[model samples]
Every structure is written in structure tokens, then in C-alpha cells.
Target: MGNTPSRKGYEKQPEKTTLFKKEPTGITYRIPALLYLKDTQTYLAFAEKRSSPSDSDAKILVMRRGSLQNGSIQWSPSQEVTSAFLPEHRTMNPCPVFEKNTKTLFLFFICILSNTPEHRQIITGRNKARLCYVTSSDDGQTWSQAKDLTESVIGKNVRRWATFAVGPGHGIQLESGRLIIPAYAYYVPFKCFSFPIPFTVQPHALSIHSDDFGQTWRMGKMLQRKSCECEMAEIIDHEGRSHLYCNARNTHGHRVEALSESSGAYFDKPRLAPKLVESRHGCQGSVIGFPAPEFVPNDEADSIGGTTSPLSPDTQTWLLFSHPTNKTSRRDMGVYLNRSPLHSSGWDQPWVIHSGPSGYSDLAHSEDVEHFACLMECGKESELEQIAFVSFNLSDVMQTVDKREKKEL
Candidate 1:
């Protein structure tokens, strides 16, 4: 750990390194999703290999593995996971969730027809997306054939939607054996659908969930009003009940946050998270609920999400959110923390990672103690050049805690 000054005092910063950058080849990498497999102590970085920075040019999904050893991370060679797409379709967005009991990983994404752009979808009220996924049994070393779930999972729900997308980042599995994939759909009122609305249709964040593992998945009711490009986390509220917390991008003034009782299915109306800002034109962000370092016990279960620690302000599940810090531009990737999950005001000022030209980041809590990783889009001149993986520690983002409160046992 490296020492850096914080609001409280000197704090430790995790070693940061760049995992991948675009070579001389014109092919660019963007939209990163990260998953940390505790059992294998491996980190999987997934992204889209685009012919250019444009969204419609995505050709294939690519990934690389990073092994944690000693105090540093060793990354493997990049490899193509699959290119299963029709000649006129492109695969994009990679969201992965792991089931501890079954030891299976599910990868979710959407395929968009080449000729149909998002603008056309909203104007015509027709979505040209196919929801699909693949499963891997041995970590990410192997994967099952791609399965198109458009008819089964998104068939009727998308009929009224102008456009929809699965997470471009990681998803979460709750303590009660539920898998939730963060998603969003653009809705146009019937009047707006018939003719071009004054403005582009805003989106609402929703989830595609599975109760009996990943055997069958269902779409959750959309969260209230304009929210998009979301991520979900299982947080233990003050009442000792497990609640699903959602944080999403918004075209409105600020980021949107909401809570759900039945896992990630139904949500309360959303409100702006004042401390979290959405870069102009909106930007995709990532969120996760993690065991507070001071409260985590040595004998905790190995499952991803489960029972809460003894109910207390100090023992509650904490949240970490990542996005760009700039109010008008996508730059200076920042990670914000909220010790109190039930309230939006608990979010602290961010600890910045990339200080320039950064956007669309995903956060993953390290199974290894006191560490976390961020997979982000950044470049020397712009945010779309390449995808990079950065690592940080708890102390880095816990800057506001007083000396005594931030101290580790």
C-alpha cells in the first residue's frame, strides 16, 4: 500500500496499473466489466473490441484474466471469448454474475442489428435488440454456447419500449439465491411514439432477475421516472433487512437512486443522489455493497451476498459508486463511498483515479482484504481510446473518516 494524504490524515493507496491499451491497430476497446472470483483469486476484465469508438461498430467481446499474487496483480494475455452474431448484428455490453453454491458464471449482453440505430428506435418506438447470455463452469476458462433469451426474457416487456440494454458492467447475486442483472429501457408515450417528441425519450432503470439460480429469468418492473445504465447491490439496512439498492445514470440534473424490497424486482420511486453527478449527456456508473472492513468477521460465509452483520450504524453494509467527476465532461474518474446505505446523503466526496479523459467505469470489491478494482475507459487525449484496469484499497476511498474511525484493526 502507498501512502497518500486524505481529509483525515495520511491514507494508503493501492498499487495502480494499466492492464491493456490500444496498440497501433485501429481497433479500439471500450465498455469494461470486471468480476473478481474469490475461489480462484482471479479477476476477469471484459470489454468490446470495436473497429472504432462508435457504438454500432462493435465486432466481438474480449476478455483477460488477472491473478492476484503477493501484493500485486498479474494479467494474462487477451483472448476473444466469442463472436457469435449474425452478419448484420453486433454483440455489446458484457455483464457477469457468479453463483457461489453452484459455481457457475452467467454472462449477459445484447445484440443490436447493424442498420437500426438508437435514434431510429426511439423515433419509431421499435427496439432492435436481442437479449442473450452464455454460461461458464470453470471460472472464465470455458463458456457454453450463446443462448438468445429475447423471446423468453424480454419479449413482451420490450414491445412497448423504444430501446433497451443490459448492463455494460457487472451484476450481483443476492444472499437469498437471486441473480439480478442491471438494465434500462427507453419508454415513449403513445403520443410521442406516433410523432417525434420534442426531446429524446428518457430511460428507466430495471432488472432481469432469476429466483431459482439462473434457470429462468424475468424482467422486473421499471424504476420510477428517468434513470438509465444502472447497477444493483444488496445492502443490509438499519432494520437488519436485506434491501436491494440501485444507482443509475440520469439525463436530469443528478444521478438517480432507489430501493427495492423483493430483491431487485420492484423498486420504490427514485430520487436524485445529490452528491453523485451525471456528466452532461449522462454516463454509465457502477455500484456495489461491500462488507465494511472494520466490521467484517473472519468466519463470514463464502457466498457473495448474505445475512447482515449485527445491526448497527457501524456494522451496516457500505456502498461504493464509480463515475466521472466532471459536471460537464467525462473526465477524472471518481469513486464515492456511503457508509450509511439507507440514506443518500451519506455519500462522501470522491477519491479520483484517472485524472483526465475517463468515463464508463465498473467497480468490483476484491475478495482479498482491503482491495478493490475499477475497469474504466480512458485515454491520453480522450475517453474512448482503450480500456484500462485500476486497483485501489479501502483507505483510498475512505478519506473522510477521522483518524480513529479509519484505522484498521
Candidate 2:
């Protein structure tokens, strides 16, 4: 742990507003997916409205619209996406990606059988989930009917998977106009030669991508490593080359990372980021890339293990990640910085934004305001009490890091 930020100053809190609160009727909101529209200066927050806190209890998808005003977000009331569902099935995992050229918002999700749990599918070696999406041309005011892409996109590959799910967060659109939706599947290996075919399920991360805008789609090759519930970002290295960076959930005590040079068509072997520890049993995290700042203080760079060389803005891409910081439990929602996005190291100790019980989160960067927004599950007693929204800038992250550095010295 060379100069890693200390775990002090947990009491310093950022201003947050609860966008989706839990109800006394056992209705809970989980799996937040956030997206920011640069053109309209607006934010779209999505989540699963579950009958209870369990995955099998997920009921439907809901969203809220937030407008930037006076440096704060004014969020509208939550609305149920009735059109983004199939009859008699439960909707879950709201993964939204915006196609800038057509100004269309595609909210991708999986519909599982009403009472079918993921574990059951894995054990039985059968898939009962359908890949679907609903598009919104005018932001999220109204959505088109859900379209089932299971047969068209996945097609024959569905037989290899016991189960699969898209991002519980947001997706990305690359500079070349390719839309990438981070996803994972529990693959059933070859069956054993027995009366009852024995199955071994292994999870791997992959992407559902469309190069010709949203007109056509296909699945990318799966990662060789065991990863799941992932998010992707496009990073331009210092040498002016673009790469797709994937950070995924794993049970190996550390997060898994892989890079794709072919715009997500395939990925290289993944390496675990030792600095980024995973919560017990694993939890979903979010990653996004933005242009590096024009100047960075030497002390700050050294403290976070970053490069100090001078580089023009937009020449290199820096990353920000959000997840639960605690290794043994899901708590302390933290935001981490990686000045060197192309490398496995240089991930600084996180700036803990929410210090109490917290769970799945999504991060979005607003270029116009140079602010990052996070929609997360946090509460005093439980992480599932409500879905809250918070925003901070680079200065705020550095200030926290700077304070911790002085305390350590």
C-alpha cells in the first residue's frame, strides 16, 4: 500500500438526495443505473422496483428525470416503465445506453420468469431469461414497446448459457459510434456422460454490441476469466489509441479487469486489480472514463500512483470507479480514481462518499459541468432502504485525497 489514502475522515459527507425511497409495503429499489445527457444537461436514474430485497422478488423497472439547476439536481418523481416489460415476467437489471447520432435511448434488461431464481437456472442447466429493451426517442418521457432480442441477437448461443444478465448500471457508446452493453452469462460446460447430464456453470463477462447504430446487434466473445455483472468504458491511451476497459464482479476477492482493442469484439486475458478489493461474495461496481485534466499536482500524482507527465486534454483518458469499499461487507460506497486507465495499477484508495451500509451503484460524468453523479443504494440500517443520488467534481475528490495524505504523514 504505497502512499494509499488513509481511511480517516469518513464523517465528511457530500450532499445527497434520495431519488427512490423504499416503501413500508415491502417495495424496495435496487440496482441503480444512471445516465447523463450532455445536450440537455439532464440525468436519467433507473432502478429495479422489487417486491422485496431479493433478486427473485424484482417486479418492474422505474426511472426518474433530473435537471441541472444552479449546480444541483432537481429530480422528478419516479415513474414505472410499464412498456419495458413482458407479460407475467419480472423485469430487472436496467442497462441504459444512448445513441447520440439518432438521439435514441435504449434501456436493455432481462426478464426472468416470475418465480425463477438465477440459482435454479444454473443448477438445472436451463435459461429462462429473455433479453429485451424499450427505446425512448425524446429522452425518457415515453418509451416504445419492449422488443425481445433473445432470438435475433443471441440466437443459437442461448443454449450454451444457463443464465445471463446485462449491466445493473449504464452502458457506453464508443467514439466510433459502436454501442456496448456490458453483460455476463453463466455458461454450462459439456455435459457428463450419465443418465442425468451433470452441469458445471461458470460465469464470464461479455458485451452486446451494435456497430451500425441500433439497427443490428451481436454478442462479443466472452472473457476467459470468471467475471460477472460488469460495466465498460472507452479509454484513449497516452499514445492516442482507444481501448475498451471492462471492470467486472468476481468472487476472487478482487475485481477483474480486461481490455479490448477491437472495440469490444473480443477481450484479452483479464487481470485482477489488487488495489480494488471486492466485497464479500462480490458486488456490482461502475466505471467511466473522462479526458485527463490539463495539469495535475506532482504530490497528488505521487500520492495516488499516477503519471505526472504533462499531457494535452483529451489525449489520455482517466477513470473513476464506484463500489463498496469494505472487503468483508457491502458498505461505505466509495469513488476511486485511476489516472492510468490502460494499466492495472494506479487505482488510488477510494474517497468514501457514503460511509454507512451501501450497495450497487452507477456513475455518470457530465462533461458540461465537469461533475460526476452516482446513484446508489444506501441507508442507516440497510443498503436497500433507498436509492440516493450525489454529485461531485474532481476538486472535491482531490481535496479528500489531500486531507488523507496529510493525516498519514
Candidate 3:
């Protein structure tokens, strides 16, 4: 194991507020998705309310509205998203994306048959999940009725997929006004049809994009490498070029990283990130890009092996990733920094945030508040106990990095 710092040395830790607590009646919350509106200084946090901790027990989507007040977040009570559902189906994976031109928020998710597990679909080679979404214009106060897009968006192609799902986290809108939703599909080989005994299912990460607002959406080509639950971010390189970066979960020892030059229409061959090790079976992670900070003289930027400084002539995009730091278990939520996002090997060691059992998490970068916020699953004994929210600034991250360097020396 590397020389990771303990949580005792931090002078000030970010305050964590529980947004959704599990009930005694076995009602639990999981799969967090967060979005920050810079114009209104509002935060919309979303999750799946499940009857139990199992995936097939997911019932509905719940949300909370938080406003920045005096440098702290004031979260409102949780509210069920009544309009984002079908009659007899269970909702999972609340993926929210915002469009600046239409001033609309799109919450995309998958509606699976009640009591039907994903393994069944893979074995039968018949998909039982539907692509759906609901729209909101007033910052999630209300939503439009759920619209089924399975026929329109993925017509005739559903036969190739045994099952699929959208992001369990947030999506992104590009500078050219295109909306990109990270998704993955389980593909069954052609030979499985004739000989159905030994089923072969492969998961590949792809994107569902819309160019003209949210009117029409199309599917992108999947990555050649195997990947699962993933997130995408737009990164501006040192030369002012935009590249769509994908970070995905895999059963391999490390995480999968890929880049797309055409705004996620297609991705290049993926590589394993040696610095970002994965948990046992792999876990969902969140990634977000922000403008690089101004460079200062005598800084230790070279120690991280980054090629571009913060004060480059063109704007540079830096990345923040949240995931479990443990290699064998989903514990100790860690936030990692990448000063050079264009390179796959530029990630630094994570700064351990929550020191206990941790699960799925979503990240949102608020430029207005100058802080990064996260909604995660953490508890004393198990990660499914509660969904909490926390916020921290760049200074907090840098301090942890400096302390780790001193300890190593």
C-alpha cells in the first residue's frame, strides 16, 4: 500500500449534513445524483428510494433542494418525484442534465419491470428496461410526466442489447449546445442466439447525445474495451482544444479511461489508470472538470508530473474524481485531483474524505460558490445507511496533498 495520510492531521474538515436517512421500516436511499445551477445558486440532489438495499427493490426517485446560505448549504426536506415514473415499473439511476438555451433540466433514468433483476435479462437475451426522462423548467419544483423514449431514441437497436442503463450520476452539456448522457449496454454475441446455453454478455460504455436541445437524441458507438457505470466530462487542453473524457468501472484491477474528440460520438481505445485502483468488483465513480487555478511562482506542480501549469496562455481543465480509495472494499471515500486532464497518468493520490464505509457518490462543481459538493452513501457499519452532502474548496484538497508529501519525505 502507498503512504496515504490519516484523517487525524486535518485542521478543519468539511461539515457533512445528512440529506436522506434510512428508515427503521427498511426504506433506504442509494445512487446519488447532484446538479448545481450557477445562475440561481441552487443545488438539486437526487437519489433512488428503495424498499431494501437491493437493486430490484428500488421504488421511486427522491430529491432535495439546497441553497447556499452564509457559506453553508441549507437543504430542504426530501420530496418524492411523483411525475418521474411509469405505472407498474421501478425507477433507477437518476441522471440529471441541464440545457442553458432552453432553461430546462432533464432527469433521465431507466424503468425496469418490477421484481425483475438484471441477471435475468442477460440470461434470456431479452431487454426489459426502457429509456425514460422527465423535464423541469422551474429548477425541479415540478416535472413533466415521464416520457418513454425507447421506441424513438433506440428503435430497432434494442435487439442487440440484453439490458442497458443511463448514468447513476449527472450528465453534461457541451459548449456547442450538445447534451451528453453517459450510458452502458450489455451486448450479447450473435452466437448466443443459436446456442443459448452458455450465455455471453459484455458491457460497453457509450453516450446518448442530443444536438438540437433535447428534441432528438441518438446513441453513440460503444468503447471497444469492456466498461460499466461511467461518467463523462469536457476537458479543455493546453492548446484550447476540447476533449470528452470518460471514466468507467471495470472488473480489472484499475479503472478504465478513454477520450473522445468528437464530443462523445465515438471513443478511442481505453487504457487502465494505474493510479486509480478499483474495488473488488468495481464501483461507480464521479468525475468533474473545472478551470485551472492561477499559477504561482515556486509551486510544486512538477512533483505531480503535469506538463501544463495553471497560468498557461490558453484555458486548461483540471479534473476532480470521487470514489472508494480501498482496493478490496468500498470504504473510505477519497477525492483525487488531476492537474493535467489530457494525460491518463496525471492523477494524484486521493485525499481521504469520509473514513468509513462509503458507496456510490455524485460530484457537482459550483463556480459561483468556489467549492465542490458531493452526495454520497456512507454509514457506520454499512454504506447504505444514509445519503449525506458535503462541500470543500481547492485549498482543502491542496493542504492534504502537501501534508502527504511531507510525510513521505
**What are the models' TM-scores?**
0.88, 0.93, 0.93
lDDT of 1 at 24: 71
Clashes of 3: 0
Query: TM-score of predicted model 3?
Result: 0.93
Model 1 C-alpha lDDT per residue in residues 348-392, reported as the tens digit of each score? 777766666888888898764778889998766988866777776
Give lDDT tens digits, candidate 3, residues 9-54.
Answer: 5434456788998999999999999999887899999999999999
Local accuracy of candidate 2 as per-residue lDDT tens digits, 1-409? 0122225565366777899989999999999999999888899999999988889999999999999899667889889999999998999999999999999999999999877999888877789999999999999999999999999988988888888999979999998999999999998877554211454588899999998889889999999999999999999876778899999999989999999999899999899999899976999999999888876545657678855655454337889999999999998889999877777887877898887789999999988445798999988799999999888888678667766767888
Candidates sorted by TM-score, best first: 3, 2, 1
What candidate 3 gets wrong by more than 4 Å, as runs, is 1-12, 193-199, 296-315
Could you tell me which residue pairs clash in candidate 1? 175-305
Better of 1 and 3 by TM-score: 3
Higher-lDDT candidate among 2 and 3?
2
Question: What local distance difference test score does each model get?
Answer: 0.81, 0.88, 0.88
